[model samples]
Target chain A: MKRIMILVLAITTGLGVLAYTTHSAPQADDVKVISITAKKFDFTPGEITVKKGVPVALELTSSDRVHGFSFPDFKLTAKIEPGKVTRVVFTPDKTGEFTFSCNIFCGSGHEEMAGRLIVTD
Target chain B: MKKLVLAITVLLVIALMIGVGVFKLGLVPVNADVPPSGLETRFIPIAVHASVANHAEEQPNPMVPTDENLIAGGEVYTVMCARCHGVPGRGPSVLGASFYPPAPQFTVQPSGYSEGELFWIVKHGIRNTGMPAWGRLLSDQDIWHVVAVLRRLNSLPSAVENSRSKLH
Candidate 1:
């Protein structure tokens, strides 16, 4: 009886902790999906705007080689492999213009491979 | 003996479950701004050093640290690396400092990595770190040139220093 009671207590505490933890990935219907393509030295749609507080899913793909997306302000980074889509989801809590750039060295023009993210209140 | 084995197995199973729960429940901090914990500070360097030693080829730098070669490396460094690693005369970059494992200010504190290790790291970036692989973008010769510059960052040739100063 003591062993059973201990097990029951452990399960209850585990469930409570899991429920309390914040989960960021929102359901499909709740997120606003945006498709962005990366090539040699540019992220198509060089500028993107999203409403603050709304979960935004950026579906990134590369047409040339492996590229990377780093939104430093959001602390989000992902590799966009050629012939594959990498989905990065996050909610913009603050409203501002943030620069997103390709952290991966692509070519001579790699330094210029950057875009802007405009988060609206 | 059988009872001891059974007790150990049960403990292992419980530990595995807890580990999985922590990750699946997003309990692990993923933020980049937070400083690394003591555990990471102690173990990560050991792991990186071991990995570099194991994977990086045991070889010497092919390019001689000639003034021209050093200058060439400086050009690449000024364009590609200075933004994060920092330039000799300038301060640490704000963008570089914001990284989870902050990008080392190599100019301020010269990297202890050997030429070969630097070559391997520049060719293939460290995973989960902000450093990016330049293999696809830079030729082998270019990489060697960069390595040459990195080795002599504290004592760059006058010509290279002059060229670096031209960059803002």
Candidate 2:
């Protein structure tokens, strides 16, 4: 009975360690950095292209008013306030066109604020 | 005695499973989707200011709160902030209503920030929210003036109440 209990504990502990190590391992892909600026309900350079399997680091800023950067498909959103720099990082696993839009209502033309991220193989 | 020990062991395993499940699957509140109202909007700024005051070791603002300075700030607020925050007797703007966290009707109750705290937020702005920092476009004095204006917002002359009748 004692040997059986010891064996069960060893198995559980081994499994837990394996899970932790696998989860903490870094990916093999490279990272690309993209800088974007928001002003007057629009994002400057409204489109970006990145390679699939690469991580993206988005450095964002705002010149006027507060704006929200939202990618609905990715369930990601961040607010860019005037005179502040914000950073968001994500890995694009699939190749597709992802829509990005401003969620904040800055002015009359707020609805037209949009951008696109094209991920390629 | 053997049966009683087996029952206790089963109960302990069940309790451990429940604990693990609760930790893994966060129990979100049922009303998590319900949006906050105008009154609740003030809480963010108040909380932020209090936290900054408690934790941030920064210099306090140097602007003197003269009546002239306040009047200048009021003018700036009327031109810039009044649309969303609203003027006296008017409600928040149409755009303000659609925000996930609705903008506060500053006319009802002025922001609970001290003069210095208000100046810092206006100059540096809040992160991940629709509050813009005026530091780039407006000079330091300009932001300070806006702060002075926000201080006196409760006593300002009433504007025409067009917002009450306007469609959101």
- The Cα error of candidate 1 at residue B26, in Å, is 0.8
Chain A only: TM-score per candidate? 0.77, 0.74
lDDT measured at residue B141 in model 2 versus the true structure, 0 to 100? 67
Alpha-carbon deviation at A43 in model 1, angstroms = 15
lDDT by residue for model 2 over B1-168, one digit each (tens)? 999999999999999999888877885333423576556566875787677577433655466666656655665566567777876556566555555565666777677767776777766677755767654344556677676667666664333112221322
Tell me the tens digit of each residue's lDDT in model 1 across B45-138: 8999899888998778999998888887888788888888888877787777888678888878888888889999998988888888776456
lDDT of each: 0.85, 0.70
- Per-residue CA lDDT of candidate 2, range A15-108, in tens? 9999999887555445687889998757887999998888898888998877788775666778898788898989888889998877654544
User: Per-model i-RMS in Å?
Assistant: 7.0, 9.9
Q: How well is candidate 2 docked (DockQ)?
A: 0.02
